[model samples]
Target: MRLQMHAVKFTADQSLLDFIQAKLDKLDTFHDRIISGEVFLRLEGADSNKVKEKIVEVRLMLPGKELFVKEHDKSFESATDRVMDVLKDKLVRFKQKRNDISSPAIAEAKTRVDEEDEVYEADEL
Candidate 1:
């Protein structure tokens, strides 16, 4: 899986970049076919609260669909963690739905083949 991270406005330091990369690398374990992803980190001004908050947006590309999750918090790490958690849930659902959609067709095909085999054997007997 390939990850491309963009920090808006300010340049991100090495440690922050490394941390983000490490966090993103683990996403592949959830779904290995993830083609690529984009992470957007934006610094937001304090609203009502005195502390500045960070906004992180994660977009992942799957085989047939795209999954997106965004989070807002005081720390980038926390925001990223939240976003990844949401994305993981979505990914799991996607996988299950995909399997569910294809499994019935597979079972139907197998039944048809078995029926054909039974008919052939009966005719031979």
Candidate 2:
């Protein structure tokens, strides 16, 4: 999947970029269908504050839907981690719903198999 990183208002170092890239890459294991993603890193709150909160925003593009997550923490890494956790849950649920087989479909398949088995047994006897 293609990932675009945007460092809003500040320049991000190579290590931070690599770290976020690695984390986003792992998401493909959960949902390989992910087409692309965008990550926005920004510092929130006023500069007067001794410590500013790091905000991480992620948008994942799928086949027909888009998933977004935002998290803030004292560190960018932690915020990114939290965002990934939320995205993971969403991806898992999305996969589950997509792969779910309806009851009627299951029942129809079972009936066909049962009929075939019965016919085979009768022919044997």
Candidate 3:
């Protein structure tokens, strides 16, 4: 998957970028269909005393749908961690949804076959 990282109003260090890349790479384990992803890191000008002001937004592109997550923390690392959690959850849910849509028809067909087998046995008796 291609990852495009953009930092707004500030420059991100190599370590932070590496951290983000590592986190996103794990998403492939959940679903390999991910086409690409974009990460936006922004510094929000809020109350100076707030502990969480840095914002991280992640956008993931799949075959048919797009997933997005946004989080704020005191530092980019914290925000990235939170975003990774959300991305993992989203990927899991997406896989579950895809499986649910594909499994019901197969299950119904199997049930029909079982019913037909029972009828054939009854007629033979």
Highest TM-score among the candidates is held by which one? 2
How many residue pairs clash in all the candidates, one count each?
0, 0, 0
- Mark the 10 consecutive residues where model 1 has the least summed lDDT: 43-52
TM-score of each: 0.78, 0.79, 0.76
Query: On TM-score, who's better, 1 or 2?
Result: 2
What is the lDDT of every predicted structure here?
0.85, 0.91, 0.88
Q: List the residue pairs that clash in candidate 3.
A: none
Name the lDDT of candidate 3: 0.88
For candidate 1, write residues 31-93 as lDDT tens digits: 878999998988887444454899999899999899988999989989988988898889888
Full ranking by lDDT: 2, 3, 1
TM-score attained by model 1 = 0.78
Query: lDDT per residue, candidate 3, 1-125, as tens digits?
Result: 79999988667899999999998998999998999999998888744644348899999999999999999988889888999888889999998988784688878988898988764566687
TM-score-based ranking:
2, 1, 3
lDDT of 2 by residue, 29-63 (tens): 99999999999998886466655799999999999
Query: Which candidate would rank higher by lDDT, 2 or 3?
Result: 2
Query: Over all chains combined, what TM-score does candidate 3 have?
Result: 0.76
